[model samples]
Target: MSTATVASAPPAPRVQKRGTPLAKKRQWRAAYLFVIPFFVVFITMLIVPLFYSGYLSFFATRLVGGTSFVGFDNYVKTFTDPLFLAGVGRTGLFLLVQVPIMLGLALFFALALDSGRVRGSKVLRLLIFIPYAIPGVVATLMWGYLYGQDFGPIVQVLSALGLGSPNLLSDSNVLGSMMNIVTWEFVGYNMIIMYSALRSIPAELYEAAEIDGASQLRVAWSIKIPAIRPAILLTVIFSIIGSFQLFNEPSLLRNIAPNAISTSYTPNFYAYNLAFVSQNVNYAAAVAFILGIVIMIVSYVVQLSTQRRERLG
Candidate 1:
């Protein structure tokens, strides 16, 4: 024991040597250098502006030096505004009807294209997706012209077929017409998303299903749909968000059918009109914030409900 103690084990090989302060400082500097740009941009563009908006939302601005803190008056006014409520209701209606139809068409097209037996699949896919590449303003303009009652080819065709041409740009039919435009522009985008999901599914699953006597339809329903459920949910959420944000199409089309789409056609359009036309920035902020919250809550609920159903099944 005494001989072993005399060896002293060389101070346990300095197992926990601490770094110098200069070395620690250099490590911290490198980390900050890597992270600073992101923080700088986020703070400058997002955080600061958001905080500024929050502050601005508390006051009512006037033409003269008459800005005054109004507290929640703007929000109260927004809630009571019939035009705002109508816009919200119209957007909800569009979300309920158009989103499902558009996404359904997208899923169908994606599935059709992903099936190896389809002829001219590549060309068809390119043709389908080309509409999405057109600018929204341009698409709206073109479709607005086509939907024209006086000189449109559709009207001419209806006249030729001895069927009376209904006014597509009337107040009663404008929402449906806009829905058609949105579907044409975005179905391809959603199709691409679903197609990507379809491509990622392993061939082995389909092969195994085929070996088990599953028909193509059964395989698509059981394997393909379940596999791409997440992408489907994503497209649905995006469609819902977009339906609420409907502006450019109706706004641009207003030139052709002014009475059909007023200043407040959708929630986003309502906010725009409030801010610019009404000169009510505070009310616009309130409406914008409310719309954002509604979208977030709806998306969260949809995701949760879908996930729960999947888990339970």
Candidate 2:
């Protein structure tokens, strides 16, 4: 009797599998969970501040009228301001001079390393990269001390060697000194980028070149350099951004060389002085926004030129 009852109850309904819609919904939920944090932080930290700055840039806060909308007056003033123009020109010069030297050195080092012929290449690479690991403030301070005319080690050594101590932080030479410091700091970082790109090239290309009796220089010029153009472009873009955003080094060096490094030495430095020192937040916002636009335009031009060259080639 038990066996008969068990057999009668044996028939059960089949469970249906979930549809694609349901599975997709679950996947979308997981994706949102992963991405929500980034969006939240980005909106809170960047988007909101940018919009607020843009809002501030259109208004004027004065002693008598309080805060009142002035339309594009702040922006017009920013475009015409000599201080702002000087800073822009200064940074443009910095980009032109420093970026070339830095990138050249970086490419040289990367090519040497990629050749696989340099002894203790790993050690040399690490040594080159160590400066970048140092904090910008620390690096600036370290360099500032070296550039000190009165008591710095460099000056002392020069004086001891009966060579007159040249003023590195002087008005005439300070920009070049800054360039040297920047080149020292960033060469390794750019080298690593180029080196990584070089390493990714197909080994068969090198083999083919070898079979064609190509010298190492010929192989690098024809294959490696062309292959790594994108990496070079990336480094150039980064250098351009960094050059325009040049603030920390100049700001820190101001204390060391007040006569040479002005409060408005760089666009960023000018913006900071306007906002904090002069208490002109509205104008400062406008200046900062304008500077951001300049950087975008310059970077866009560079990218466009690169693309055009690629198309032509």
Candidate 3:
């Protein structure tokens, strides 16, 4: 019987002592060097401004007594101020009316493109997304020209066709016109988001649905929509934030429709006018802080409701 001596495995390769502690320290030091600049900029640009704004919101500047600490007086005034309330209500109305239409159109476009039936869908997607690439200021100006009360193509065409040239920028029509512009700009942006989500869904799931003889509509209803609910929710939250921040369009369009677009057209515009036009910096800070709170509360409520609905489902 040969005593088989198991050869001891060649001495295990040492991990080379994961480098000396100094080397590890130097590695971490280098990593921190890369990370510090971002934190510095973030704190300087965002954190400092936010804290400063909060601080400014607490004080009140008065002609009679100069700047003085006023506690929550500005907040109280913000909640009660009719102009601020009116602007909030207008934006709320816009949120209710426009968000659904825009998201619905985006979903429709996403589904259409995903179905692979539309001719030249790639080009169509690019065309749709092109408006979003345009700067908001530029887009507003372009639309302002198109919605012009005089010499606009729409008015000219309507007159030529004897359909009666309606004033698109009239007080009653301007909000709706703005809605159209926002929808036109953002639908494709939202569509791209949803489309990307749809693309990430497993093809096997689609194949299985097809094997079950599910129609396109049925597949989308049961599979596509449910799978992309997170993306939809993200879009909803973004739309809500954007609706509250509806400043650029109204501010620029005020030039075209002075009577229709007032200084307090939206919360953001109200804050801007308070700061620059009326020279109410303290009050503007308060208004901005309040607006930020409103946005935060609304976004929180939406996320909470969505969470509850998902859990229940």
Cα displacement (Å) at residue 6, model 1: 42
Clashing pairs in 1: none
Per residue, candidate 3 scores C-alpha lDDT tens digits across 1-313 of 1111222223234633655544445556666877999999999999999999889989988768899999998999999999999999999999999999999999999999999999999999999889999999999999999887679988889989999999999998999999999999999999999999999999999899989999999999999999999999999999999999999899999998999989999999999999998888899999999999999999999999999999999
Candidate 1 lDDT (Cα, 0 to 1): 0.89
RMSD of each: 8.3, 8.0, 7.6
Task: Report the poorest 10 consecutive residues by lDDT, candidate 3.
Answer: 1-10
Off by over 4 Å in 3: 1-31
Question: Could you tell me how far off, in angstroms, the CA of residue 300 lies in candidate 1 after the best superposition?
Answer: 1.3
Instruction: List pairs with backbone clashes in candidate 2.
Output: none
Number of the candidate with higher lDDT, 1 or 2? 2
Q: What is the lDDT of candidate 3?
A: 0.92
Work out the TM-score per prediction. 0.88, 0.91, 0.90
Better of 1 and 3 by TM-score: 3
Instruction: List ranges where model 2 is wrong by over 4 Å.
Output: 1-21
Error of 1 at 164 (Å): 0.5
Query: TM-score: which is higher, 2 or 3?
Result: 2
Which lDDT value does model 3 have at 145? 91
